[model samples]
Target: MAPTDVNRSTAPLSPAPAGGVPGWPTGLTGLGYGGDYNPEQWPQATRLEDVEMMIEAGVNIVSVAIFAWATLEPAEGEYDFDWLDEMMDRLHAAGIRVALATATASPPPWLTARHPEVLPQLADGTVLGQGGRQSYAVTHPLFREYAIRMATVMAERYKDHPALALWHVDNEIGCHVPRDYSDAAASAFRSWLAERYGSIDALNTAWGTAFWSQRYGTFEDVLPPRAAPTYANPTQQLDFDRFSSRALLGYYQDLRDALRAITPAVPITTNFMASSGTKGMDYFDWAGDLDVISNDHYTSAENPDRHIELAFSADLTRGIAGGQPWILMEHSTSAVNWQPRNRTKAPGEMLRNSLAHVARGADSVMFFQWRQSQAGAEKFHSAMVPHAGRESDVWNNTVALGQALKDLAPVKGSTVRSRVALVLDYEAWWASELDSHPTQALRYLDQAQALYKQLWLRGVSTDVVRPGSDLSGYDLVIVPTLYLVSDSGAANVAAVAERGGTVLVTYFSGIVTPEDHVRLGGYPGAFRDLLGIRTEEFYTLQADEQVSVTGTSGDLVGTFGADLWTEKTHLAGAQAVAVYDDGALAGLPAVTRNTVGSGAAWYAATRLDEAGTAALVEAVLADAGLTGEVEAPAGVEVVRRHGSGGASFLFVINHTGTDASVKASGRELLTGAAVSGDLTVAAGAVAVVQEG
Candidate 1:
């Protein structure tokens, strides 16, 4: 039977602390379905109906004022809060919480018209047209002033509003283009370079600009490296990336400080676009200012592995906030409107995806819209109530999911305890791509995604940790595509390996240092001795070239692309786990394992395919004595949350279309199910298995 959606009374909500909201709500873990709510857009008479429908579908919170800049401030010197005041009042009356947002993402038409300097310039010196939202540059002084003003106004006005729960900062700050090379941007870039290097000589040394006579005579000569074709210098590009990230941080900090002044009680967050170019914005720096880190995740429904990416994104946010529960600001209820083939989410996919986030440590869940728009860019975007309103199939599905969330409120605030951490570095991502390599097809995200899937299938709790994380407790640490490794990062890995922890280093790792400079002496620099291998020469092959490597022990076979930076290495103290069986450099080491100190480090000399990566991951985990610990069924996902209570709650979610067989050894918290052997779980089933 489809679950009947319940009202706010059953929607278990964690209250704010005595003084303020304590470290963001982490409880009765379930999905909260409502996004981009703008009651101001609809007639006042229609609000009650919307609220009734929302409550029936278990939507406890609404993300309001996403792009209301024009309405909030029609002119430069004036502000209006009449519509917003009424909207909040109506939500309060309906017992619905509000994710109050600063309507500064899209500047008012009048403000942009009056101050065109707020607009960003493209990389090739072309000025960006001011029509779309988030078109302004982060460093623009006028943009900063108006943005801060809007944020301050919202914070002060909603500071005491009982309905205000979470603060949604600027909407998708870097949605559009990346860096600009305008005169203003160039001036700011030069100042940033001056602060970073202190002098032109140091700058030259870092970029190795002397090789191409690109040495700067003065700081003024350094501009945002945006010119295309033959003029793209990777070193300059890296600096521009760092500069843009800092600039975005400044904008975020400005609004964060403003919100802090009035509403110190509620958490503030900005929704980050999950997959995008220009990794300039450091999520760590941005997350540090937020009470809860929120993200806008839209994935292809056709790909079964999309859930893995979603889990990875959630883990990334959790890592940034030190395991604080996060919110999903936008997710398509059925299918995405943006993709060419707008396929509807399968019968059980929506519920499955929602539970997957909970399994990964997501505290709150919401989508892009509650009701569909009649006409706009997102008119066709899937929502709780489609264009067909409450009569739609999507609406029914949404209502059923809401009822499930309300029933699972007892599982909220559960903490996740992970045994494996995959090291994902943005600096390495930038350095690897910025270095002009042989294969343009080598995608860093895809490689990281591949590794994540391997860990997921092995029933290991995994997290995408940053470069400098505490790796003492973890049994296995997987570092994929670690292209740029600083001395400190290398030291951390060494410590982990020396302390009897297994470390897996993949291809394209340890090529460059932190300052965008190539490591001196040998490739993989500080890690060469630890890895027990030295790579002297490297070559690249075509896209179709296959790398066939034979394993030394297990009949495990490995295959990967030989088209990207194929390295020839001599194993010093490491044992050859796999060797290239068929290639010009046949019988050479393609995969090696080195036993250093009390632990071991496995190095994959080439990028492996899905099957190959899984095998390698299984082998690594087995050697570390940490494989298949959590015995779960084929489609049933298992997750554990640990915290101050000294108890762990394992969530077993069956998001499959057919009945799933699930078995556990812990006491079942939701039902009095037996804690032994396998049990059949109905479609869209969720079970909280607790282990004290």
Candidate 2:
């Protein structure tokens, strides 16, 4: 069954817009469906067949020219727009819009060979050679000049094309070449440092240069933290990570500005690798600059919990978009070519996966490519049309998903409102696990995914926001393993509790500043006042060691296990929610909850086991007034998206082995079945309802 039609417009499909910019494309009226189109790789006959197939699959948009620099300008300063023009014209004629790329993701061979200085270099000073993608250093002057020129040229040529919907700046900006330590990068880093610190002495103080007499005499004397005799400076490494992320963002701005100056009406964005696969670029800093938030996700076939991770990625992307509807720019239609063992999808898995993204907040669903490549490194990658052509499940699923999205037109422009906020700071994620910490077992995403997964399994939607965000509207705020925080940012989190909201802070958080300087007085120094607890020292447990904890008195009741960490924690004014029953800190408080103003602040001194975490989470949810009945069966998932006029669309996904049901009253969009009080869902299937 496909999605039911939600809108009765004159045209069910959309073409490239002719004018003003909207949240989505001006001309599109329904959920978007398409994939990447590399038309230059095929002949004219094949291109025609691809267009016909797209129409049959209900594709309304396609991303073109992402890695077409080599074809667009095979020679220096010489250009060819013939193939792109033909493709754009043909797609528009077939009612397919284009998310046009600048073709600057990778430079042409001629340019790279002519200006070898633009090549990226490793930390050991090995300059990367050509023959791969993303070969150019972002901060290299020549590379920036060439890429900016490329963006300007493409904007000038396609400014009037009818197939232009969105301007895809560059494909996955930091996927391959996230960091470079070349001479150009060194210069840029120095300039960035100078701007940030203003003086050499200030920079030395921030970097803690007095410890080993490593202070620099001038800005020019500094270099990247390259392969040294031993471990490099922690603060220097932290600063470079910040500088590199800024440098890439600056490069994107350079291109985006050029495109905006020429074509002011078209929206521009770049695909972000926001999934667990990438961690280099701080996407929170990149969100404000985007006209639309887009992300690419790939799940491992080996992970039994891949669906939960997908839910996390989608929710995090939607949060980055400020809870607005965004696009799923690229995902695998089946087994991807990159994993160690690429296993094909089971029956009905693809449909469930696509709807899961839509349930989270994706207005459009797209894949890596439209047709399976017969040649190149990604030839083994799955696509909408596999080598088996129309008979393959991939193609059949693609067609089904397309019609399903078209039927979800009413869901377009709706937003997902999350009352819970999970603080996720990229800088903190980078700094928390840096060398020379309390324990090597401390991982930022590990702690975050653990908490987020529990919430997901409970059918509770979450918003992953940057630390220091305004938490006024949220009833529950969770800060997980945040090792770095600014003073004002910490105050902002504290104010959340001051306003009668429940706040949960985990261990190893609030330990450092932005410059990697340890917070003085005590561990979790920033939140000590709010949490009403003091931690004297950290106890790092061995791999095989485990600890036991038990709940105390009223409201908090459970006896559970923990591992990998402990702390000599003493309660200041708060009561112990859970106390360590066995460990170095036996009989001391492992978890405490302090009433602040009218709200409460809870702290965990160690990583609790699964049962303990779930128990604690349940109590916190009750404290925040979020407790409720099971809306769906045990393994079934339910999320609602709110639209205008109190209208909501309920998405129910059944991941269990047998049939399950949830209570609701609505017209089912997927099967056109009427649901009243009880809604039945088959195993491993999905349903969407326009709830009244």
How many angstroms is residue 94 displaced in model 2 relative to the true structure, after the best TM-score fit?
Answer: 0.8
Best by TM-score: 2
Candidate 1 TM-score, true structure as reference: 0.92
Instruction: Give the TM-score (vs. native) of candidate 2.
Output: 0.96
lDDT of 1 by residue, 1-692 (tens): 22111111211123434665445522212545567886666777777788888767777788899889888777766778887888788777776788888887777778778788767888767788677677776676666777788888888888888888777888877777556666666767777788889999999888888776787788877767776566467778877877776676666767766787677667777887644333656676556556667877777756666766667777776776566667777888887777778888877777777767766677677887887877677788888778887777888878877776665564567667777888877767776776466466666776677777777666678867787888887888888878788888988987778889888887767878887677776666667888899877665557777776667764344554333445687898988888777777688887888998899988887776666777788788887888653676665567777745676766776756667665556666556565765556677677766665
| C-alpha RMSD (angstroms) for model 2 | 6.5
- Give candidate 1's whole-model lDDT: 0.72
How many residue pairs clash per model?
Answer: 11, 0
Highest-lDDT candidate: 2
Model 1 residue 682 CA deviation in Å: 3.0
Lowest-sum lDDT 10-residue window in model 1: 3-12
Error of 1 at 11 (Å): 34
Candidate 2, 369-430: lDDT as tens digits: 89999999899998999989999788999999888888788898888877888998889988
